[model samples]
Target: MITSLDHLVLTVADIDATIAFYTQALGMTHAPFTVADGSTRHALRFGESKINLHVSGAEFEPKAQNPTAGSADLCFLTDRPLADWQRHLAAHGTRIEEGPVPRSGATGPLISLYVRDPDGNLIEISAPLQP
Candidate 1:
């Protein structure tokens, strides 16, 4: 039914911090966008999906008070999935809980690993074989 994972949204406390963490730590480039209100959202491009981090100054209170961890898992296409993640995470001091598992689901078979972002949100890095 689903063609591919398009994007994932995350509500974070520190917008710049989250941006820096993903850009510097995970090697993602912040893509350009338009912000309608004073509130803003950042889109970082990593392979196919764009990880979005939104900031809504005081309008949304729940995200500021209570944050969710590992609510969503994201994957990136890489030539060396495991090695690239290992070096990147190590350089940024991010620890891996579990990893590099061969997942089987509707998305098909893929090699993946899991990690958390600055706000403790879970992320997956997967390399899907050619169809």
Candidate 2:
């Protein structure tokens, strides 16, 4: 059985833009690392969690079952409030795809703000509601 999610892969239409959006808007750091095949992969790291970016159309082994850009819908929990995420997105000229609405998180209640990355991937930024 799985204990927790370690990392996830995102097939990106544009790797540079994806890196910029996550690093600049979401406060994540870009960590470029090389695989065993001597190819480099771009990733965004926040603490122990990370999201690896694979350029669409590039050949890579051991990938997602459905590795299509803009196909993933993911939620990220933050200690910062939804308002903060909203502000960051607005400042970066990133449009809110949905809203800062109430939503149910996997472990608890949450308030989430939705946005689309350059690849049009649905990104849900969430803050946990106080118990």
Please give each candidate's TM-score: 0.69, 0.92
lDDT (Cα, tens digit) per residue for candidate 2, span 1-131: 98888888999988899999888878899999998889787889987889988889883778877789989899888998777778878898988888778899999889888888888888899888997
lDDT of every model, 2 decimals = 0.70, 0.86
Would you give me the overall lDDT of model 1?
0.70
List pairs with backbone clashes in candidate 2.
Answer: none
Question: For model 1, how does the per-residue alpha-carbon lDDT over 16-83 read when each residue is reduced to its tens digit?
Answer: 88788789877889885766656554688887778666654433333535435335565555666587
Q: Predicted candidate 2: what Cα RMSD to the true structure?
A: 1.3
Candidate 2 residue spans exceeding 4 A from truth: none
Per-model tally of clashing residue pairs = 0, 0
Q: What is the lDDT of residue 57 in candidate 1?
A: 44
Judge candidate 1 at residue 11 and give its lDDT.
Answer: 71
